[model samples]
Target chain A: MLAKSFNIHIDNQDLLDEAFTQASYVNEHKGQNLKFYERLEFLGDAVLQLIVSSYIFQRYPKMPQGRLTRLRAAMVNEKSFSTFARECTFDKYIRLGRGEEKAGARNRDSLLCDIFESFVGAVYLDQGQATVEKFVQQVIFPKLDEGMFAEFFDHKTELQELAQADGPVDIDYELIDEFGPDNDRSFKVNVSIGDKLFGVGIGHSKKAAEQRAAQQALTHFDTEGDNLV
Target chain B: MLAKSFNIHIDNQDLLDEAFTQASYVNEHKGQNLKFYERLEFLGDAVLQLIVSSYIFQRYPKMPQGRLTRLRAAMVNEKSFSTFARECTFDKYIRLGRGEEKAGARNRDSLLCDIFESFVGAVYLDQGQATVEKFVQQVIFPKLDEGMFAEFFDHKTELQELAQADGPVDIDYELIDEFGPDNDRSFKVNVSIGDKLFGVGIGHSKKAAEQRAAQQALTHFDTEGDNLV
Candidate 1:
């Protein structure tokens, strides 16, 4: 099944099984003596980092360290890994405990991210660095090339750069509203350029909301008026 | 110099030179068209992570993900990397700007750490993964085997386990003082077990200070009394 999905021959089936198995499942079924994916995740995390870092390092030779770091962070962060997991159909293969399965653990971003790393780890151990690097290049590099990273767009920085063109206009993101429970709270933010409220956005985090608001503001500037001049 | 120090035959001396060259040096000597080590540092950081993660994963099969993560962080953190750099005498080989050299940039932990990562990156690029892994195994695994990682020892966890053995006891770390500039601040912390002050420690950050205090407390417990019972 793993070979069919990933298009790589599995030399060791147990490593693949361990990659799919969650700690929750291992704890519940103590007699089975199954190893979880945590160790694999640790190993995979490093593999992913190296592959992504090398790709970016080669692709963008003139880019500064700070920018390279930011880009790499965006590519390998939890959200990005979760996206990769979904693309690879990891949710279908993931082994969760009865309670976790009932609670929709398969859809959880963190769990999905961990599973993706574990899969990489399994690949590294079973096949070796060359195979893992090829796999990551095929899987991840396209996403990076397509500008899936938030840092690639960087709406806030764009807005700031635009504002600076018009002699330092004061731009601010105000949290206009916040609601929902602690675990899943949403924030509504308004991006104001000087006195004008240009755009509003909603997100789970204040930073996300602010970025969205800034993006919206930039769009408004693009479509409606030459606000910067 | 690197070949003599690391005892590895250098296939590309230029790559080794690039690893030691600081950005400040590049800026100072504009016509030389020399590249800095930042890109290599970025690559090396990932390589280091993979190597360390593999080592720990194989060494400790039963350790939990959280503990493993903590242990990896301790081993690969700025302080640890800086220590490695010092051990390798990277300070003597590092290329700095005249101004930075005058300012003693060679002794800077951040610079040392960056240089160390760059060196690893250089090795990876020059000789490939097998050679780099052998180099890292020779240099780094010995430190891990010696329990150089504080998270491996885990003073806080040890203290908690010890306290549990003697019935329920409240352990707390209080920040007694914070001084110096924001960039180079020192934090003084006191660790108390029950109502008695067990140890006091000072460090650059609160967490470091707390860890030191806990370590000191554990040392006192080891020498003074059978605190476990």
Candidate 2:
């Protein structure tokens, strides 16, 4: 089934199985001392980074490092990887614990992302870089050519650039409030441009909150006027 | 000269020169708009990640993903890369502006690290993966085999593990104080185990301060005996 899906020969069934296995599944079968996809996932994450970075580096030679970094960041993230995984129907094959399956973790973005990376790692181990590269090329390059990841620009950076485009202006992210238990805390951030409050956002972390705030600020600038000028 | 040092034939001297050219140097010669190494560094960093991760993944199959992650983080950061850069005499070849040259930026860890990665990127562009892999294998594998990066375990994680080795215990890092200008500030952190203060550390950033605090905490535990039990 895996061989047919990727259109590549995977000789090692054990590696493939390991790639699909999650920690929860392994924990459920602890006596067997089974391995999971995590190690492979780590390897595959690096593999993906190289493949993606190399592709963007070569494809966009004139693109600045900052932009390349942003592009790569946009591409090789949980959201994008999971989306790719779903496209290849990886969720259908993911081996989850009974509890996880009941909780619908098979379709979870984080899990799908891990499964995709682990699968890539498995392919690299089984077939080698040439085959894996070719596979990634086929899977990822088309979406990239269509400018799928262009939307994932860093909001904070975009805001900063916009603020500085006319002239330097003070932009600040202020943590206005935090709530919830210590373990499940959330942060509320208010982003201000000079004297005016442009946007406010809430997230699980300050960075996330700030990003959301910046995103809102960008949206504000999109519809509203640029008050900085 | 670079070809001689790496013992690989690099046909494109322009790419090689671009790898060594710093932005400062390019800025000094405005009309030329000569490309610098940042873009290549970005690409080379990814290349190095794949190469190093692949090597370590294959080498220690039983090593957990967490350990692999830590090890890779240790190996790929400024200290290790800068050391490797010096080994290749990269500092001698790095082109710098007069101001940077006088400021001794050529010998700086961050610059050296950037140059090394850019050099790898240049080689990847000129010679491709196999050649770059061979070069990195020669330069990096021996150091890795010697466990050069083993010392760089995340201090906070170490402290937490040590604190919990016998049973669950509270480990907390408190920001005791912060000082200096807004743009250039320092953080002071105190690490506490249970109710007792174990370490105090200072750094340019909160994370760094926390790491230092943890490092000191680990040292205290190592010398004064773990008080958790």
Candidate 3:
């Protein structure tokens, strides 16, 4: 299915087989000399990162490093990879132990992500990087053109840009409170423009809280009759 | 200097200049129409990751994904990159603001690391990935051959392997205490084999503390003549 979908060939059946083999299956079928996908996934992740980075680097020559980092992060995470895996219908092909299958590990996001990466790895191993690059271009670049991943840029950056679009404006994120135990700490933050408090948010990390606060501030700008961009 | 040292020619002098231009330099040299290296560094980082990952993946086919990750982490970080930057004498060529140069940003590790990445970016832009691969092979692979990065692997893996070399001893890391505020918390942990406590460690994070504990345990085995590998 992947071969037909991507229009790529894999001469090494072993690599393809290893790409879909889960550790559970190997654990259950010990002494059978079966390999798992983790090693391939490891290699594939770097391959995917390089291909995606190259694509965006060429596509958005003027984009800053920070936004590029954020955009790439948006595309390459477990959620996006798992979605791609499902599109390839890899869940049907993964070899899992009976226990893991019963536990629904076949459709699990991390498992799907690993499968997608391993598939890429297998393709790269069989046909090298150029083939893999074409594969990624076919599978991922269209979605990029559609702006499918643009929403993943955090609200903090959006708010900062919106606040400064008209002119120079002072935006501040202040940590208001921190609480909870060391292992499970929480932070509260408030976003302000000049002297007016715009939004308050609470989260597990300071960055998260600040982002949430920024999101609320953006919401305020969108809903209110403010002239802010 | 870079082209002569790497034996490669860059047709585009602007890209080469941009590779060495610091943000501070650009800030100070406003209206001169200058560019900085951050964007290129972003792309170069991904390129370097893929090349290094491919090299290590092929070099250590039997290595588990976890060990491969650790090994890659050992190589592709600020410390190692800065060391490589020094080997190339990047300090002699980096363009910095007057204040930054006076503050010794030329020799700083973070700056050096950025310079190294940007240099890779410049080479990739000029000569392409094959040239960059050869450049990295020339610059970084010899260090790998010399096991220059071997020491950077976390002690936890070493302790685990040494503990299990003789038998299937149950090794464990237990967090004893966590203290300090949310932003600056510290953890204390101890590693034990079976029922015997091997060592204790303290660090900013649990993983760090566990690694330190493992380091102490390795030292114990080394100094106490424990007949462990």
Q: Write the per-residue lDDT of candidate 2 for residues B1-229, one digit (tens) a residue.
A: 6567678898898998899999889989988858888989998999999999998787776667766787788888899999999998889999999999999999999999999999999899989989999999889988855767545455787788768879999998999999999999999999999999999999999999998898788876532222221
Query: lDDT by residue for model 2 over A166-211, one digit each (tens)?
Result: 8999999999999999999999999999989989989999999998
RMSD of each: 13.8, 16.1, 14.8
lDDT of 1: 0.82
Candidate 3 lDDT, A91-187, residue by residue in tens:
8999999999999999899999999999999999899999998888777888875767655555787788768878989998999899999999999
Q: TM-score of chain B only, all predictions?
A: 0.68, 0.68, 0.70
* Per-residue error (Å), model 1, residue A61: 1.2
Query: Which tens-of-lDDT digit does each residue in A1-229 have in candidate 1?
Result: 5577667877888889999999789879888878889878988998888888888777776656766787788788899899989988889998989999999999999999999999999988889888888788777888755767645657788688667666988898999999999999999999999899988989999999998888788776432222221
The C-alpha stretches of model 3 lying farther than 4 A from their native spots are A152-157, A161-229, B152-157, B161-229
Q: Interface root-mean-square deviation for each candidate?
A: 1.1, 0.5, 0.4
Model 2 pairs in collision:
none
User: In candidate 3 chain A, what residue range of length 10 has the lowest lDDT sum?
Assistant: A220-229
TM-score head-to-head 1 vs 3, winner: 3
What is model 3's interface RMSD?
0.4
Worst 10 residues of 1 chain B by lDDT: B220-229
**For all the predictions, what are the DockQ values?**
0.59, 0.63, 0.60
**At residue B224, what lDDT does model 2 achieve?**
28
